[model samples]
Target chain A: MNVMIEATKLTKVYQMGDEQVHALRGVSFAVQKKDFIAIMGPSGSGKSTMLHIIGCLDRPTAGELFIEGLNVQEAGGNKLAEIRNQKIGFVFQNFNLMAKATAVENVELPLIYAGIRKRERRQRALAALERVGLSDRIKHRPPELSGGQRQRVAIARAMVTEPAFILADEPTGALDTTTSGQILDLFAELNDEGNTVILITHDPTVAQRTHRIIELLDGRITRDSSRNGVGA
Target chain B: MNILETMRSALWSLQSNKLRSFLSMLGIIIGVAAVVGIVSVGLGAQSSVLDMVSALGSNLIMISPASTVARGGSVSGDAVDLFTVDLANHMQETVHNMSLVVPQVQGSGLLIYEGANLRATLVGTTPSYPEVTNYHVQTGRFLHELDVENATPVVILGSRIAENLFGQANPIGRELTYVVGDRRHSLTIIGVMESKGQVLMGNYDSQVYVPISYAMERILRTQTVSTLMAQAISAEAASTAVGDAEFLLYSRLGTTDGFNVTSQDEMLETMGDVAFTLQLMLAAIGGISLVVGGIGVMNIMLVSVSERTREIGTRKALGAKRRDLLMQFIVESLALSTSGGAIGMILGVLIAKAVSDFGGWATSIEGPALAIAFTFSALVGLVAGVYPAMQAAKLDPVLALSHE
Candidate 1:
């Protein structure tokens, strides 16, 4: 399998007035294509920071990070944004669908950022929503959709760009257990269809649903292992 | 991103928040409207005043005895006769570019024509009076130098005088009898002057004009003419004509206090200066409102950026360039301001039209003024949108995403 992401000693430090807060400390990991993986951690474990770096939403303070063989650590904000548009899809915890935009419009966001033409963007967005089993909810706004359906639209949005990987940060954080199960099932289905998926969550149940789980603690990696015969 | 796509998205954003957009545009609307309306009104007033002053004649100038002071600066020059027929004749002969110089003597008389009696002004002027004042005879000949030389008892009746006395009958060759002082004099009517209703001086249409010789020698017997009407060759030559008249009058009278030479150009310039000042003051007032509107736009846009922090983060994570979010917010504000400006333009025009049609005020609405107002509001939008757009663009995506 082609390695989609490689991070060697990634570190993130933020200055909170007089003291520095180390969100990520010398974190290292690799994500292969079509990999169904979970980064499991508590609140201050820096999984979100690692996800941000992998998603190309931010650069590491001190480290070497590569996505699709390009050194993302050296990329500027605009370049990283372009890289993200071309390579990474992000699903947020809150569904993160623009409340005013229709489901199809929300799903079309990444493709829009990728500079796709209007007709093609719409067609692909429709197909992505269909793939997520949300074909009928395309016209519904976030407020009009159920929690599971809104997350489905967010997945469709993340899927529309055909990126190297889908990075979901606590994707089921706001949903109930049944909705969360449905969203995880959709993610598994997407992975089965040959899309790489990355999940950042603290829930052990969600972590066990993936093929591999990487646990982080105090901004450092604690464990990286694969479990056979899991739901991929 | 394509500009068209960005604009469409901006439009959608604004559409989703209708009330806030309109309330934000209110300041701009009122500002552009006030500016356009005031300028239209001022321009109309200026044009009307210019027209009224020009109706006398564009290159026309009037020479009158200046007001003089005695003791406490009270005007006491009513008894002074500062001008004579000779000075007028000299100016007419030697004045450069002077088309016509007509000396005039004013008097009041009672006319009796076939039992129709009316009290009217009697003007004694040279044959050149018609040329100087642009008063052309409608039906008959104007006063001639031969009639003046002969001191003939002939008169040119004003159109109103002819209309009142002869009804529809031709008054040329009709004998008109008039009482100048205590004696009744009969004169042959030669022509009727064209109707020039009421001018600044008085109603010329109700007067009668006779040769200077006949009016002065036979009627009022005045040798000193109080007023002189001079027509310059063109608007450009009026100053030269005035200079000539002033030089001659000053040389003869030996005192500048005796007479005043005033041109329509001078009156027009003075009135125009006053109008300009009024327009500038109005523009300042209008500009204040527009600035207030701009500030209002800035205030709302800043608030909008703050409220949409999460959305900005979403866009950023979705691979949107910082410029995308910046452009989105900026275009939204621009649309708000320009739309407000357009509506303000319409409102201003309506207000101006209402004032002119209903309030009986004059107002001129020019296309360029509307363009100016429209463009200015768009500029205000651009300037006002800058800070908010920068704030949005500068937002950290990680922090923004964390914003509830």
Candidate 2:
């Protein structure tokens, strides 16, 4: 019950011609409440695969994944959708905001799925964008804004739902150093507000900001350690 | 989600690709329009026919002896037995709402007057002929009851015939000799009838009229009338007159199955049925055009679905249900068709009116025809939209999301 994400012997396989490629080789892990964990690994190391499975966007080939004490492996698409709607917020590396929609509209995407009324969704989306300090740029479309601004809009979109877990797959991967620092400070502020944050990054500097880091090499965790005090 | 929200979203999405959406709707528009226009034209034709039939006098009925035309020869029934003086008298007395009855005999003859001669139809009829039919005297006067009783050597010339023979001179009180079969009879023209105009049959003012007794005794040489003409009290009494006349004639003749009794009402009803059939045929023709239009819509919508893969993915990710997406597309198609149908209906009515006004025909634009055409067009849209909407709604969200 204390574990937020409990993966037991989770494995994912792919068919490559006549051979089976193992993405996750019976990997198991856990994270407690308010834990800010970073997942780090080289390319094709199954870090992104693990994040996809944990985000309920894909199912593991074999094993059980429990989040908030509920089994997710057998849940149907609708149930997974509901879980994704209410419990998880994802930020992709490429900042996948709808091209036609403005910043606030993108942030209101999850609330729209939650069946919130238009006026209220707009208000909440605006508040979340203000928290990321993009309040004046609500009407800006993804193309109209800089790469960093688009990423902040995506972060606001993730945070607007006020979900239990924030899943950032390299939130600052496309941002400059200055914009990366701003986004990292926003994520730290959200973690300070007692929201569980899970960031996956290849940059060690990005991983250093989290309370704990889990480093994987070739689909196996080579290091799992806390830094300063807090899950540290 | 509420319908309004769904519609708003649909409208927004449609607004994003105005040209594509409009093109997709083009099919429905053309289809609905074709249906409305064609049916209106058909209904107008039907109305005109009915009006012409009504103007011919509602109490009138045409009866001809049933003849069998064979490859070798033709067989004619005994005309005397079918239309007799006794039968005419009985029809006048027994048929309720009966006004008058006139026995008629007809043959082709030559009328000679003032050294001018023309081939014309010779009609031997009672003085009541003018009353039973709608023809009236335009010159001197019609043959009176005295003329028929006395079997006077007198005649009534139709306006056209009188003009040809007399050349604007007073045809009444003039002498004309009619040659029929092998004999010629000198007759005085006592009256000239006004022209009633020709309809489907032919010109009315091209015939000459004389007493039935004179035609039978002097020319035909047989005690048999070729036809009988009966007048009803009013147009509304036509059906009653037909029923009563049929019953009276059947009882008098002691038979019913071998004869066909018809009134102007029956003729008009037959014409109405024909007009309705024509209207249906026209509607079907229009429907073919609509179906082609629907195919156009389907083709365009397929393109739209393909082009909007990312949009569909976005909507699916936004939690749009399959039914919602289906409804959006269907509604869009319907709006297009209905709008087009309305415009087509106006165009059809205008076209029908123009024809009616120009040709002086008794034409009409039927309301029910317009309604049916519009509804049918909408149905076309619904049918056309189904496949494309399904294709759009069934797109996998992951695949759509990954699409550019």
Candidate 3:
């Protein structure tokens, strides 16, 4: 199906020391193949909560989440894990590469869980790094790399599994303005290569780069807009 | 996904916290070392004990009157029945695995020659005593059957007793005076026993031998023998010989009163039992330390999990199963404990060897004890790692990612 991730009236309630915090309230959306989308919101806007459900990291309290035509809420913990392994690729803003692993080793993480053999995982990780234009920096750790290079390494890791959708959670949150721009450009380039890219961020500048932006405010979607031409 | 990659990842994590990991493993190290070392020491004690017991002879069975504590203890039957005279005949007729049986009556006397005076234990027995008890005559000749029948006034002195009396003078055919109760009698030294060596029991070189008839009728003035030493044809038949002797004694006396049969094997077994009990106690003590060490691993693992919240989140995002996270942490803990146990075993062996070489306490580490100690340590690790690993696995991927 072209509809890679479809959510319907998703609700999430979290207990925080005798108080109920409504993280998400009946949020509904769908992401299609090759579609570049942004869920843009400030802190406490439930954007992260939404990404967690779509990434199969959390199940909805009162809704249905269909990832790759499979309902995640009905899936067991192990099945959800398998679905996440097979279908999701998350790129975090911190460039969450393992601190001790080299760029190539960081990229190999997903395949390692996917039960890919070592030699092929190495080959695929090398190809993924090459795709991110990090062929020369594949042996460097995240601590040794510049912000933009680290983001590229994270992107390489996200793309290593060749998943249908790329979930970018505040992909430029930890970078300088110039490095953020470079990372945004890399996202647009990856989209140009026909990977569905979901950018979760608060910055208008980042949302302007996606073809569609679903803006949320206090656990509910306030705006859903589509600007079909690729870059801002 | 696979064990190799999991272990590699675990290895990497442990390597990152080398000092902390090593410190955490110290408990296991000490625990395993103590267990292995104590076990070796116990086994060594057992061996030394076996040496002391078997020095009397391995295939030899000693029949005494209950109360004398040997290396081990009696096997099954009760005690005490005079198998004295007809004992040898019954044994030869019934037990086919017999070799020799020497009845012994013990007495003590003061010996004097020139300016030297020595207190000596006198053993009265037949000519078969040396063969059954592994003693040999170094010089002159042993007493014969004719000497026992004739109540010969000849005596065979132990090496030390002969040396004390004779100095550089030849003791053979020399006149020696022995005082019994207040009466003194003169006897001729026919032979001197070879130096068998000294033990905790007594020095064999200080004993003097006389024929049973000569000792009981003249010196001891009694007919009751103190103990009997019997030799089986082979080591395998030693137990059978004890059993046969016990059966014959039971059938003859209808009770075990006045007779106790002890085998070298039984005595060795008792020593072995003592070693086993000691090892068990050591293991329990060691296990407590290992448990404490396991707790140390758990404590460190908990800190690691809390510290690596974002890392856990990233792995979950990259599709790590609960079992994967569980496996990773478990493997890390297991690696810590096993490595610690190995180092501890080496240290324990070294300590044991040092004690054996320099401290005079024998220590021996067998392969089985080492294996058991190591496996127990690893099991401790596994148990200790569970809660921490489960805690890490249960972390919320979104919240963990948000953690600094």
lDDT of 2 by residue, B1-404 (tens): 55676566556666666787666656655555666656656666776677677666657865534443334563344333667767788778876677877778887888887578899888888877776677788977777777767778898888888778787788778788888767999999888999876644556689888887777788677777777767778878877877786776667556564456677788889999988887777778777877887777677667777877876765555445566567777666666556656766676677667766886654556678778877877787778778988888777665675587
**DockQ each:** 0.73, 0.22, 0.64
Candidate 1 versus the native: TM-score?
A: 0.86
Candidate 2, A1-232: lDDT as tens digits? 4578888888989789999988888878887878888999988888977887888767899989988877899887677767777778877677877787789988987787678899999999999999889989999999999988898898888878887788898889888999898888888998998888999999999999999998877777777888975432
Q: Select the stronger candidate by lDDT from 2 and 3.
A: 3
Question: lDDT per residue, candidate 1, B1-404, as tens digits?
Answer: 77788899999999999999999999999999999999999999888777667667658988888766665765566425656777678788898778878888888899998879989898888888877776789988888889889988888888899999998988899897889779888989999888987665677799898888788887898767878888998889999888888887778666666688988889889889999999989977988899899999999999999999999998998888988888888898899999999999999999999999999988999988888888889999999999999999999998999998
Off by over 4 Å in 2: A1-4, A14-21, A31-38, A93-98, A101-104, A137-146, A168-222, A225-232, B71-100, B103-143, B146-227, B231-261, B318-371, B392-394
Off-target runs (Cα >4 Å) in candidate 1 are A229-232, B68-80, B84-86, B104-127, B137-226, B233-237, B253-259, B264-277, B360-362
DockQ of 2: 0.22
List the TM values for chain B, per candidate. 0.76, 0.77, 0.79
Residue B161 of model 3 has an lDDT of 85
* Candidate 3 CA-lDDT value: 0.86
**Cα shift from native, residue B23, model 3 (Å):** 2.3
Backbone clash tally (model 2): 1
Instruction: Report every candidate's CA lDDT.
Output: 0.88, 0.76, 0.86
- Candidate 3 residue-wise lDDT, B268-344, digit = tens: 78777887787688778878887888888889889999999899988988989889999999999899999999999
